[model samples]
Target chain A: MEKKDTFIKAIQENERLIFKVASFYTDSKDDRDDLVQDIIYNLWKSFDTFQQRSSFSTWMYRVAMNVAILHLKQRKRKVPAVPIDLGALNFAETGFDGNEEKLQVLRKLMNDLNLFDKGILMLYLEDKSHTEIAEIIGISKSNVGTKLSRIKQKLRQQVNNQNQKTAWN
Target chain B: MELDELKSNWENSNNRPANQNSLTAKMIDQMIQTKYDAKLNKIRYPEIGGGLVCAIAIVFIACNFNQLDTAVTRSTGAIAILLLILLPILSFLSLSKLNFESAVSESHVQVLQQFAIDRLRFQRYQKMNVTLCYLLMVAIIILLPKFFYGKDLVINKAFWTFAFSFGYIFLLVFSRLMSRYYGRSLNQAEELIREIKETTANS
Candidate 1:
């Protein structure tokens, strides 16, 4: 019971990160809820194995991304719905209320990247250091740096194209 | 739109307070317990259901074993009994390989790499299952008449025409639908693996 309490506290603390990852992976609300539930469940299951060499959030993000890649890309097997009040818990709303347009554009660009690069981009956007990003993603720090630069370049070109088109209009 | 600009915007916008509906201990317990019960989970229900059905089927087939007078019935009865015995074992074995208990403990690269191999193996098993199902469908159809009314439909010429035309087409369409569904996921995984491999090599 105490362990469960600890786990719940940890989850509530980092729930935003979980929702952020879930929203990045899924488009529809149903899929988002399912993914969030999955991330939470996986985190709970792997909770015992967490040795805490890193921050809890960092470890949690690793687990979240790992599950998301193997999960969201795999065939979605619908599990029985739990009776949790998912409707009441607007976790993935992200508090990005005023920047809907910017959020949409960021999401559009993020969606275009593959899962691997998206993970990198997500970590980058979260302002994760190259070292921490490398640690979480299991790449060398140099690789994290290299991937981020390439992703940035891709985003730059995309933004420039969008801007040019807008200017022409 | 640039990474830095978006990063700053995201950081700023994400600063709004967390939702008021923070989960209570009771809610957390329920959520976790729901999955805990599911540790044996969705397939377990079907497995139990299937095992009982198979048991009943095998019992019915055995009880009437002496009455299977025709060659097709006898041969297909044997096949159906074999199927009843083997299908459950096959399902249990295939599903047993899909454990995700240790997934979150592994690194992202390791997880994806293992997932690629596991997905291929799972795809192969699915293909085998579809083929086995085709055979099971045939065997069950051949034997249903015997089970219900002691008639040997295999001996009837019309039975073959009707069963093959309709049965094969039904199975074909169902299998095609399943294949297309899984094929999309397979393509996604394959593409992901390719891109990850390229990134790994370049890095």
Candidate 2:
């Protein structure tokens, strides 16, 4: 009973990992939440095999990423019932009222990225080191460094372009 | 903006889903239930429905061999017999090569997705083979009468042979057209698999 309680408590504590990882992969709010649930469910199912080779968080992240990627692949097969408008999430009604413009621009840029780029960018944004990012992304540290350098340059150019277009307006 | 600023903006933003609501809880619950059920279904029946259909087809063909003409019957019987003997052997070979538990291990879903894509390609090839074989059989059936009736046949054997050949050619063209139509979807599925593999591998 104590072990079960501890496991459940750990899950509840680390639940935010699911949301963050899921949001990185999925654009739609519903799909993001669904992906999070799938990740958690997978973690629970595989809980018995959770060896102490790595920290629980590391294990959880691995499971979360696997589920998110798989879910994204499955999602491609179905047509969306309603098109998601990234702009709509920026409105006051959606709880993003304070920094709507910045959030909207960032969301647009993130949405433009392919899945692998998005995963790397998300981890980078979360302040993970290149080494840690490589572990999370299963890439070499040098590869992560090069990719991040290019990604940063691309993002800077995009922001500049957006600013210039705004100035013209 | 600087990279740090952009990263900060994303991190500090409140655009993320609110975690504390009944609706959110219910949605998460549903997702968990659905994933659990899917996992159960996968474990209970790892083989896809295509394998089951192939098994049934072998049984049906075996039971209907007498209905076909002697030459076709003999050729098909030989082929069917070969397939029946080969299927289990091939399946066992592949199964032996598979590391089933490792393929589905928490760290290796991407590998499993690749396997699924390969299976889909094999299924598509099978469908194309069946289509081509059927078209050929239809042509053979139409032309066989011409050879038997010999000069007494109202229509010339060569004429009917050419006609059947033209029809067969048209069927082949049609099959290609249909395959192209379905090919777009298969391409999309393949792309999804590639995306999953690349993402997981990179991560």
Best by DockQ: 1
* Model 2 C-alpha lDDT per residue in residues B113-159, reported as the tens digit of each score: 55456546655654555564564455344433433432222245776
lDDT of 1: 0.77
Model 1: clashing residue pairs?
Answer: none
Go through the candidates in order and give each one's DockQ: 0.47, 0.24
The ten-residue window of minimal lDDT in model 1 chain B covers B14-23
Assess the local accuracy of residue B176 in candidate 1 as a C-alpha lDDT between 0 and 100: 85
lDDT of each: 0.77, 0.59
Clashing pairs in 2: A137-B202, A137-B203, A138-B203
lDDT of 1 by residue, B180-202 (tens): 87897677678778867876787
Most accurate candidate by TM-score: 1
